[model samples]
Target: MTLPLRILMPLLFWALGLAHAVAAEPSGKVLRVLAWPGYADPEVLQGFSQRTGARVELTVVGSDEAMRQRLLSGRGRDFDVFALNTAELQQYIDQGIARPIELQRVPNTRRQRPRFRELSAIPGLIRRVDGLTQVYGVPYTYSEMGLIYDRRQLSAPPDSLQVLWDPRWRGKVLAYAGGTHNFSLAALALGWQQPFELGERQWAPAVDKLVALRRNVLGFYSLPEESVQLFMRHKVALMYANYGLQQLHLLKAAGVDVGYVIPREGALAWLDCWAISSSTGDPELAHAWINFMLEEPASSLLVSRQGLANTVSDSVASAPQVPLRWLEPVESEERREHYWARIHSGDSPSRVLQR
Candidate 1:
């Protein structure tokens, strides 16, 4: 589909003509795709459109939580396919929100890396639902939540997540505004390996960590672009990079000199995959969207442009040996969200955890 420019240009004009003609009289169905910003590039969507004569409606999600809200809000039938991390995918499967993908339909799974190809072996990627184990998602893009520091502010890179708590960087540090990720990060910073399974005892320390972060940071940001803008506008010395390498790329491209590091305690990461909606009108078309994403141009753009690691290529900068703890379905998302709201609103840890 990625033809040479000389060849692609003529085809582009012809495709445009065809599109205009088709606009008068539609033929193929619309495949709605729910994914992050860089996943559904205009060129890739257009390529898929030209190839199958199908229209793709892409909706970009700012966070994994937002994607969850949208999917559950509609009983999973609102969209044909959605991009979600393995953890969220599991919840969808349990709730009967996702449909099992037929291996025969998604031939691109064969083109994935050795680790990804053996989906059954990977933890959380495959799970038993209703007494039958099934594959849920097609692994697409992934990243770790590392630390970022301004080169001019820090003589050397930070070696631990504790730096974000340093009083010296008070009102100059940046942290993700989301409750779920912040809670996981606080648990990890506290040396709790099982971040997703925090008990009552773990709640106090985690809440304290979040309260401290809120007190230290000038203001928390929710999106990668927002983080970039905040860093440039403020004298940001340190940051808890929620988007990891993707944020680093955006900052550098905007001429901000920053350094990224995985702390001694390691980093929290997410493996985002494409999943079919239970309410898909055309499973074949939905499968085609996932398959198209694995192709050369789409996979390469994820690395070269967004800095996220793709399943098919090794060209991007990936810290393979660096330890990463993948996100998982937590004990109670509702409880975490409730407490997190209070923590953000300046409630004392003791008062916040009183419940």
Candidate 2:
């Protein structure tokens, strides 16, 4: 079946089950979740069910847009918990699809890093309203956008972002095709200060630089899994990637010679958070799932095995290659908005190639 059909079929069945469950006698059980890939491994859910007797069922979402649309469609009422990137959390909160998390119910909330907590507490981060202290989401895993290169091909990894512009490597480099982050990376490589916080004037320079790099790019990938495969097959020598550890592990398992690096210029850091759906009837089950994730064993598994850094303090120490400072809170909203708007305005893939 086609990809869209594959997704829609399961979703339709889920909707039917939800309607039947809601109308029939309420069971005060079954914790449904909408999560990203690898977020709800069978073992993880089994452990939660064993301890709480709340059977956990999960639906995996491919992107932030998919998650938002599912929630907006009122299908979110079927799930007790949802995972979303910090960038898109505010929209869910504003739409009332997600509600403020009840901290007292989640004891493990205290285990999170101070910086993670502070960022989660920031009103505008999860809600557009001003001066609201309501905490709507619990920060889970953190990631950064960086370069993954085949060490066997290039004796040493490129130290600066400018290497992407090198003609010798033309048609051998891969980049994320349709995102502000890639554009921001290009701008940084071209010596634009704080590319993520660009102004209208900076947009032209960033776009010009991206067009130059596009000339050299072998291909553009939208999915992380596909990018990882490209590296393994040697279809591309270098790629802009997220989850450095995860990608490295996959490549190593496939016997691909690869390594990841943060450029001399910093990269963009992103956090994913767990939020309870306002429409959920079983708050306790949702709370249990959140606490289960924050526990040391699970947190460590997430970090060491999945290569994602958990916000909570646990058995998992920071990975050797990832810097702790990059996990710092994002820049102020004003700066982020300016940069986001500037980069997005110049994000036409066709325009990028024309230049």
Candidate 3:
């Protein structure tokens, strides 16, 4: 009852091809993700890939400006989903680069805390687009920029932002190298109530203040690990915790004695959220990525590994009892960067003011 040899051979090849196609189906599908550093750890991405048959390509951004440039490139077709602070999310939504989220597709949102569940309560989460109010982002994690001082070097925690400029601590302080946040911090120290909104008169003064800060600091750092190294190696007496509690955790884990405090001028806080790109090729896959981030492992990693407060759980380490000034759209981001470049490069106050 055996078939002819040629006929048998053709059938065998057809069956092998079918099996290979089935096995490679998942490998063919890919999901591109853009997020902040530590937001998408390798373990978390691997979990998503294991549970679903889709591969994840993750891109980690260190600064808000860098994140914006990446998303804006190629009409935002390069990434499917990205994480950004609520304050910075407005510009993307306005440019039509951000797409509305379909809540039903992301059922894991039910697991979020009540404050996050009410998206409408948040100022920048829901926006009117084409005559319809739509949800654009899902809350993920947050932290406030506070001052971290060495316990052995100081009598107690610094109570104000002015401590960063104290002459006694000159050459013994470490500060963030970012322009936007540093400008705001400088404005606050100068007694300006609206730190983010600098007037024409406030610009030169802020620049001069930052110049003084540059001379005072041991050095400027852009990453949490670098800050830790500088703080430990230089015997840094005080630091502007740009990464907030995350930096504190890193320093403590490194065996350094440090204490964190929110300055009386009010700490700048940021709420980072997950959002979809308007040019995403597969909306369903993007939604899945967002949903997966809310799961236990991904959400818990933000707290345990990154020292951030996740939307799904209560924070174990509470921020100090001080007013938290959530970041708002600055008067001009580009202008801040322009001025800060000169200040950071050791430009003189008068020379920097020439522009």
Candidate 4:
């Protein structure tokens, strides 16, 4: 007494359709994202998800170049959001990979700090061949290269970059090996005028100084976690690191004794921003996530947990230690290019490996 085949098939189809109708409904849904290690933590994502029912998938990337390669490989749309440093965004905008952000749709945009808005939304920051203005990114955090040292190893922290080459500190210092950010900051401490605006003539002396320092370096580290680990293990006494607050918090939590100092010459500041992929299919979801991140509560959590400044104004009240001026817009491309070329010449062997 089984039911007829046609009737059973139709009933089964109806049941399946009903089940899909119930399951496909989403309160909030987000796609994958690429970001730096400490930029977003599990609790931060959980808070957003709990509030909006949106699920966030995060992929940690170490460098801007790695993010670029991932996006350019034709799967850019796989992620609804990605984080890029301001310098990296310049290249992304030039390549037409980043889509313009419509702040009007995200009301929380008003919550962002004035400096963050001024830097990211500035008209000429990312110029295009067309006359249209493209605001393609939103800054999340700002960092400056500084010295991270072991309080137990050094009675007094070095005051300037020159100590990197001192015979006493030789084989006890570490630095970033991949980019010119740390090197450029070090050059500034060495009396290089206009540290971020070097010319060919200005580079020779900088290279010589860097080469000498490289000779004395314990090793070059490519990742912050590794850098911290080295310090924890007493592998090196001092290293060039991003703003100390974040690392300092982690080290303290791990029961490691460390301290950070901003050299007298000042430091090279960098801003990391979030941008939607031009290829993203779910723009609404992406916009929602960005807006969610800008909300006061979420922003506060980000600052308190990660030691990164939220881009919005309200976030600043909780993160007063983050210097607002560091978010200032970079100089013209011509000037940046001049410095970029000199610092990235690839001619010096010392630049290849920090001995």
Query: Which regions of candidate 1 are displaced past 4 Å?
Result: 1-30, 53-78, 118-123, 129-132, 315-317
CA error at residue 251 for candidate 4, angstroms = 2.8
Query: TM-scores across all candidates?
Result: 0.80, 0.74, 0.79, 0.69
Q: What is the lDDT of residue 274 in candidate 4?
A: 79
Arrange candidates by lDDT, highest first: which order?
A: 3, 1, 2, 4
lDDT of 4 by residue, 52-109 (tens): 6666777655444556667878647657788776666766676767888877767776
Candidate No. with top lDDT: 3
The lDDT of model 4 is: 0.59
Best candidate (score: TM-score): 1
The models' CA-based lDDT, in order, is 0.78, 0.63, 0.80, 0.59
Q: Write the per-residue lDDT of candidate 1 for residues 191-278, one digit (tens) a residue.
A: 9878878897888889989998889888888767788899999979998888788788888888998988889888888788889998
* Tens-digit lDDT string for candidate 3 (1-355): 0001101111233322221111113656778887765676667877888877788877655456667677777667988898888888898999989999999999999998877898876668998869988999999988778899999999988889989889999999999887888898988888788887999989888988999999988889977778889999999999998778788888898999999888888887788889999999999999998999999688887777767788888765544355666677889888888888989888898988776
What TM-score does candidate 2 reach?
A: 0.74
Summing lDDT over every window of 10 consecutive residues in candidate 3, give the lowest-scoring window: 1-10
Model 4 is weakest, by summed lDDT over 10 consecutive residues, at: 1-10
